[model samples]
Target: MNAHNIDIALVGAGMGSESCLTKEVKNLIDNADIVFGAARLSNSFGDSDRQNVIDTYRVNDMIEKLEEADKDIKAVFIYSGDSGFYSGAEAAYLRVKEWAEEKKKENADLNVNIEIKAGISSVSYLASRIGISWQDAKLYSLHGREYKGRVPEVIESARYNEKTFVLLSGASDVIRLTDEILNIKNVILYLGYHLSYDDEEVMTITSDKKEEFLKGEIKEGLYTAFIQNVSPETKYLSYGIPTEEYIREENVPITKEEVREIVLSKLRLFRGCTFYDIGGGTGGVTVDVAKISPDIKVISIEKRPERTELIRKNIDKFGLRNVTPLTGNATETLALFDENNLVKNDNEYENYVREIIKNNPPDRVFIGGTEGQFRDIIRELKKFGRKIRVCMTAVTLETRNEILKLADEDTVDDLSVVEVNISKLVRLGKQHMMKAENGILVATFQL
Candidate 1:
């Protein structure tokens, strides 16, 4: 053991099999003084002494072991799959690099070297085995993490992209996702089980066999999947989804496409923000905001049950996963969203409601139909005690005046208003005439 130097290698073991190991990674493992990985990865190399291999993939545990070493050491941390592709190798490398730098600063004579080796990712391996090019596929991972709207995001991705590749946790996840995929038309599901092992299996489920396949049992193991959308929808780069594209009823009012565009712009949405679409009539505004990003959590609150159902239909038509439609009065719903209200109920339904309210607080808000509860809703929003950007539309003078009155309140800032009037050309017996719609007042403020 030398006293002055330490060398570390962060290696990607590749697809849980010896055959998938890269030559460089194999060589590093062969000569490593100490190895760190999960038991499966460590067991793959039979020749390596068990005493020198730590059966743990956590970076902190590996670092602690290294710190206890009395002499200079060559340490290797093995991660499954490509180091760069959603593997623990990246985090291990970063943490080790930071640790080494700090150690060098404390001891002038110490020398530390760190290197990262990449390996075959499951995406590429599965794609190769099935004779498909993965360059066109959109990749997502659900391994060992909780992702909000996981199914919906995947479904939406499959709709827009020709192929959607997902790295899943286990058998249950595969079944759950497959069940959702079965609802989509003209899509093929390619399921890979225990990839790269001797018993590796891949099954292709088409629309024809989906019903039969869903009823059968699924083998439990690490899984990777691909959904091929035969007729992928065209991707739209900007927001304002046309009004005709939505499922609208004559009675339930929808924010017009023109007004939606202006209101969304005024709200100043950003990624991962929580948005409250209070009085989400037909969910037009809710869907538009949700389309901005899957990370953006849009909760659509509607007072009428029929309108809430209509909002849900529009959500389904658009294949949006990030919008949560709740049926209740806007102000009353806001009151129920409090954590105190959550503690009062212990039922499964209340638990589900608790998760949503506890996790997402409004970062931005859109008040579409207040039903004469405008001031009450504003008061509820103010209770959050955080800066919130608000945008609302008013077709009545009373609502417009209510918005203006906020300027006098100390809690509100940057209050501004704009009136939008739009006209469309309609065909009247071979002649086109401009038809005017009611003007809407768009108000924006910060709270």
Candidate 2:
């Protein structure tokens, strides 16, 4: 061993210093020359003798101190929770490895060794206390991540996952997320707060008192995780949201659940994909697309004023923040840029896409209400290059043939058409019967 070498060890401290420290980790920490970690975590070692502990949480500062130390020293970095589950060990390991590489490049003889030891994870502990298996739980965290675009995932988890757990922090307080879920009225929450601590509290909240429970004074404990059961076995995973769920206007056209599911299936959207629901009608497609993922941006383009308002209502009812309703003809609205840069020329649609859509070309476009400008819309999509996906739905055979003819002329390859006829149940009098909806053909064109 080099006299000037530094030996670093990353040890998971579980929840805190009060308890849950493994014997091996405790021994390694006790034998170290100097320790570094968060203030509370480092101080938890109770290593006051020789004043050898540095109670700081800065990674760069630790690296610098390790480099500046003169003598060969045993250094250990402390982290909370298990080193396997979103712990700080991986981050510290990378920084230390980079430092070791740079040092080796400078002196070729420097010796550095890093050892990682695991500890109990809060999620596992919580699951044990709740008497449930975490093997199937969906893990998520708002501890240091954005919550607006992430809530939909957790909500969907509750809907489709038997046990879904989310780590809570200042970005998305559990109470705040629960309040948002209140609008959905479908989740049953199981909470674990301050796990393994004296103040640890575990509880369950059902629909009966969820509103009042969320409204109550809820404290942020030492650590918080929740298991939400939306009963996936009994629920559809949001793609096939029923037709009657949305707020629709009298005699206004709305995409039925069956057709909407197929349209979204054809679109096959990914994360952060931009979707255009031209002739959005009741915003069913837009709402369903937005529900697919929180980060997916959806724009509803409708020329009708009443339908636009109805779309807005559906959006509000669903509590979706990723959708925008633009009221204007697709031919005209797709031409307009943002508030400050509306395109003056119809041919300047590319400029409109750049200025208004934030430089994001439509990843997928669903045309349900393009009047006679289908040819123009097809031409514009083809002009944009091969990165956009287009799916158009037509109720009449003539419209379907017209779109197919345009697709052929545009050199669009392998265009597939799926005709969907939804059979819904209706009451004829005392008994119910299947009501066959109009057979609609969905034409999908890939660029």
Candidate 3:
């Protein structure tokens, strides 16, 4: 759109100043009869005609002023970041449409044209500065909004796993989010403030100390928080471990690598899932569940007391929030989770899970190591109406027998058992393949 034909051009000022301004945006600012922008930002429009400029935060007021301006003169409204992405342009367009409609009702003849010009968004700039790409990162804007409940899932996901996150308007959310992060343990935090400015500041911290800093106990400047997993040097030092971590040492722990593949595949977890790895042997399966898909919260139930304690210790080390460790028989705890106790629903066992996913619905459901009581758990899972894909692993003959029984049952929508075995390449004078002593039977149900 040509500025001369445009009644007003809403331009972006990039993130900071004139130096970051695009040449086209600079020209528009220079030639306009009047400029509309934020007070702090209007000063950046060097060489602009000051007498005709208007500086205010309210777009409605600006629209009114623009409507009253001389018809032949050009007016430019400047905004920070891209006009198309969470900028004021959408609000301005709606307001202008409303004004035009009201004028038509009054039978007044007025032509106030409008157009938008895009600019580089702060997300792109900030990500570029950190040598990260926006293609995979989850983007969130906290400006003028509260993120108390809506933020926990994403924050926990970013904190627990290897992923990237971009945030705007983070000045207020850092504290509450940090609290949520602490509950998970061992999260890494990076804060960037006044980016691309001469007074720009950045700080990195752990979830344990995020609250102290956000509370102003630690002096810092305005910034955005980037929460990520701890690197290799500290990987074993994470605050929370998946309940699955406990099982490995008990001589019954699911291998971390094996569990990771199974849980990720069964859950198909993209966002959130409340998974219960019943009969969790030490918690290895649960840890892999939480670690591989940070979004899937795992609640593992083991009957042994020592195993329960081990799960807690591991959770503290890995910093996983998406896991809830329960010590007791799987059947009893599953019974206590009445639908009434859930976010919603009643009469179904999965409602406890359903209520979680209803309030926080899971993308997948897993019942790893359902041996002797496989049929009973399968019956309970059926009550949730099949929104979840239930997966279970059987290793021993007794467990495999239970799985075979489950596979033959008609109560479930569909059931299949897969036998998996692996071998390692062994070499002495010659090379040979040695069967990895472990074998597993995986049962899956779809409803």
Candidate 4:
């Protein structure tokens, strides 16, 4: 088990060229007995011998090679961009450190030293090239990962922050993101292609010209994007969105603004919690809750297909990607979501529901309309055996009585009720008058 002293250095190669390498990194590469990195990074250093330079970016493969190599050697692992910013350097460092720790435990005399060198990140390079500060920008990377939810997340980040920087994989990611960006207004996309290389190209396009830009050809390679939103929506800081702001059908029922504020307050939402808006009519409550945090997954279930379509439209209008609309009876949907009945079926929506529920069960549940199956829905939720906060709004006396009856149930706890009465100012012939809307009773409790 005895091993010789080992010096492991995880170095950042900066942008894609030799000129971007820090002087210290260059010295490490020059003096190291062996080097490990992608072919592009390892070959960039002309002085390093090809025999000593191992062309492999996989962390495990690098570790395996290091283990098989001779002891008492100075080994360097090169990573593209800054080692700390969404680069593989972090993983390589951790894995090597773990290996060194285990080896040292077996052999006390073995000297293992691991160090990480910070290189200029693409964000910093692009920002400097464009004459902008990156400290105020939000950074994200879609490289070597699933990007299904990331497009909306980056778009939402741009809407809230003045600048957003995203490290993309290739032309596919760029096209997908730009297609969504075209729907937004007042935001500009700055794309950096093959940054720091001889053929590096930087293109700036505003939201208006995104269509034409997408129509033309985009060379595929390493890419990074910077989004500048002139007007960030600061109003999302508060929960209550005016009902008039939503695109609503005259026949569909929408939750009142005042009532939604009370319901959201009672729900006490947190980041990354799964929320279910059962009986979502116009999706007013779903939209408000989803805005609270992009991490929150809001599932709006409506029985009527028309109402579900309206919810989708509202989600699009607000540029929100976290809300998923399910069209079916609320009680039936609850049954499908039950722990025992959840099976991956051919239905895409059902499978999606199962995945979300299985991974992140409902932390918060809001029932605006129960369709007279209120008790059945509560019973199904209780089967999950997790602490869930439930909020319900009742406009009719029967529905109010049904909610009140839940207080006596063994599954319910911390029950509280509040009646919200809203009145609007109206103009009569020569004077203003107060008009009263329907009274809503809001009930909140724990399950």
Candidate 5:
């Protein structure tokens, strides 16, 4: 707006100039002597006249052209989406800042003006179109070529809550990311690409069905997918089992109701919390936790090769998006904790938490069986101080004695137990009676 100066405006034309452009933005753009924007956006101008125009992927090029323009000239640099919302304006601002800094050092008499304008983002657009309440959905961008850690937390969190995820990026990584989380079941996916563009496309698929689409079952390339949880009604069985069907069970692998309730109670499992259930049995505890709190992530870890398959099946049957089935023993499976707790000084307990959860520690630790080495597992967990709640179930008096011995002492804080007796109702000619199944619950909380 200044006279005798190069005034730069970073603008977002929104999706298709017709839908996103506000009258205020249109006015500023109309008055500019020079305009710069993406090729697609630049073409959207139709027959509009302009003194000069530039097209390029990078905003720095646009800023350079602005710097070379005549003094007192108005120039508008445009980008897609809202300039403030994952648009090119952010990079433009950085380049402009650097250019301004360099100019100030050379000439105190010269001044440059820059302003960033707001626009709608694809996140909001896709959310609105899908009828998702934007207020409930968390937002993130995996399109940043420079970002790495962005998608994991976002994906995990979404799986935790079954939130509507609106991703704006290449379809190449969609399957790869899904493969990484195949253990999580009942996820619905929707991918939207080039929104508001002539070639724009959107598609919907379940995570399990992603394979069908990935195998070129769908011919579309530039497309986005919308996912929802629509697992078929589970096949009735005496108990929950893996969907794979071929998985062989060993060593009393089914989870007793008593054990599951105590595990859920102690872990304090809830939506949005991530955890690993070591030695998950029939995925009962993990599935229960996930179902009870859809936002909490419950991953089942089992070392028995046969049991691993069962865990996966159970995940699918229950439509548990929050549960992930992992196959491995305590030592190798939980190495993250081992590496975290290993320090120079054992007495440095505070450093223990700083090393573990700060780095990586399952929010809730469930020691259903302890893989035949209870002492070592308990010791490894104790090293982490607190911030991890550990629960265990013991069937034998000796194992119970060991658990009690550990709980009796403050090796881990807030240790408690629940001994439950559950009985099944057998219909005797329209009558039912209770049969008791006994189990002990041992829980210890820290931090």
Candidate 6:
């Protein structure tokens, strides 16, 4: 159990600098019989010949080489950045634990003696470089090799956290990520490229006219990152917030608060659900879904830019991060993720969203402003699965008939209908009177 007699040592290589390494970690590397890490990383120790330092870019290859060594050999694994972050230390530890557990059964005297040393992470380094505290930041990595498919989830994380710290892989990804983020107004970007090295540079840009500034600074194959500064929104976990909390304007409509509560309930959203708000005018229902959980991906689709602006304004006012406004017709925007149409294209945002659709798909879809394309939109959503949740609200008798026409025994499961009518208090001189609001019929299906 003694660290000094450790048979396996994992050391953190802070920003690939020998001077930044801890004295204890340096001593471990100097006294160890073998060292393992990526070629570029392990080469930092090339000046020292007292130990046999093995280098490989792949983690599996590193483990295989480590296992091939003598059973009693003292080895050290070096990972760049803080080993506590997404530095692949957990995976390596699990693999080593499995090896040690299996080895103990075969050999009577074999015990895995492992020790970990902390190092500076990119998040900490960037925070120091930008003079900002990362104590309130959410940590994420786009540099994962195995979990590469989940890279698009970075946008999802940025939606809820006031500060999001992302580890970049290359310029392509950084551009794609920042472009997707710029879709939402009020987000300020702080980028740190080649952090802690001689060519290191830190840049900041507010939302106003940032595309050209970003273009001039981006270069391929650089160690890059971006910190999103957002206003933190308090989640109203107690039922729902009052109607006046959201921004409202003329020509842009929103669902009534009472109907919105029942609509979200019918959606049956669980953890990590992708909720689509078609005809998402003013984002009233969007906020209702997002306030419940930060992990949900809520997309508000509207045709008019003015109404889209209302949604954005509402997003900023409520400090909601998970809700995004897409300014396109629902029929067209939803088609972009269609399985047949979404091959590969220049639109990185579309491609990124398509990947999420392929992996998670929409768990719940709300049709509030279908704009007479309700049948087409539902058909596209049906492509995801037959057993998905679809909730639609009709405010008029004519629109209610259209919703009923889309329902059938073959397409609907556990189908049900509910009507919500609300009356508000109004002041008339010295007395209060009840003013009736328009009623909405909520149609939901297990399909």
TM-score of each: 0.93, 0.78, 0.60, 0.93, 0.62, 0.70
Best by lDDT: 4
Q: How far does residue 86 in candidate 1 sit from its true spot (Å)?
A: 0.5
lDDT of 5 by residue, 28-127 (tens): 7788887777667765642246457666657667766766654668777777777776666888788887887787666665677889887777767777
Show model 6 residue runs off by greater than 4 Å: 1-6, 46-48, 103-111, 122-136, 142-166, 169-253, 281-283, 286-294, 299-360, 369-383, 398-416, 427-432
**Please, what are the lDDT tens digits per residue for candidate 3 over residues 44-73?**
673354547677757787767765543467
- Residue-by-residue lDDT tens digits, candidate 2, 1-447: 244677888988887745788888888789898898888789978487854798876778888888776667888898888877777789889988998898877765677888899988888888888787888788987766677657767766666667788877741377777666545555667677777777778878777777788678788555456656554535445587878899988888888778888888888899888888889888889998988777788888888888989999999887677787876667755544344444355655445444645455588999997788887676666555547788888987678779768645856766888777779789988999998878898888776
Which residue ranges in model 3 land beyond 4 Å of their true spot? 1-10, 16-78, 84-114, 120-165, 168-192, 195-221, 224-248, 255-275, 293-309, 315-321, 326-358, 370-373, 396-402, 421-439
User: Number of backbone collisions per candidate, in order?
Assistant: 0, 0, 28, 0, 24, 2
RMSD values, in order shown: 2.3, 5.2, 7.8, 2.2, 8.3, 6.2
Q: What is the C-alpha lDDT of each candidate?
A: 0.84, 0.76, 0.63, 0.86, 0.63, 0.73
Per-residue lDDT tens digits for candidate 1, residues 137-167, read 8999988866445665787788778899999
The TM-score ranking, best first, is 4, 1, 2, 6, 5, 3
The lDDT of model 4 is 0.86
Clashes of 6: 2
Q: Per-residue lDDT for 432 in model 4?
A: 100
lDDT of 1 at 411: 55
- TM-score of candidate 5 on Cα atoms, chains taken together: 0.62
> Residue by residue across 1-447, what tens digits does model 4's lDDT show?
555878888999898698999999988888888888888888776345444888888888877876775468888889989989998887777888888888777779888899999888999999998999988788999998778766667878888888999999999999998888757777889999999999998999987788899999999899999998888777457778999999989889998898888899999999888999998999999999988878888999899999999999999888898887888887777777676787687889877766666666689999989878888899888877889999999999899988777767665899998888899999999999899999989889999
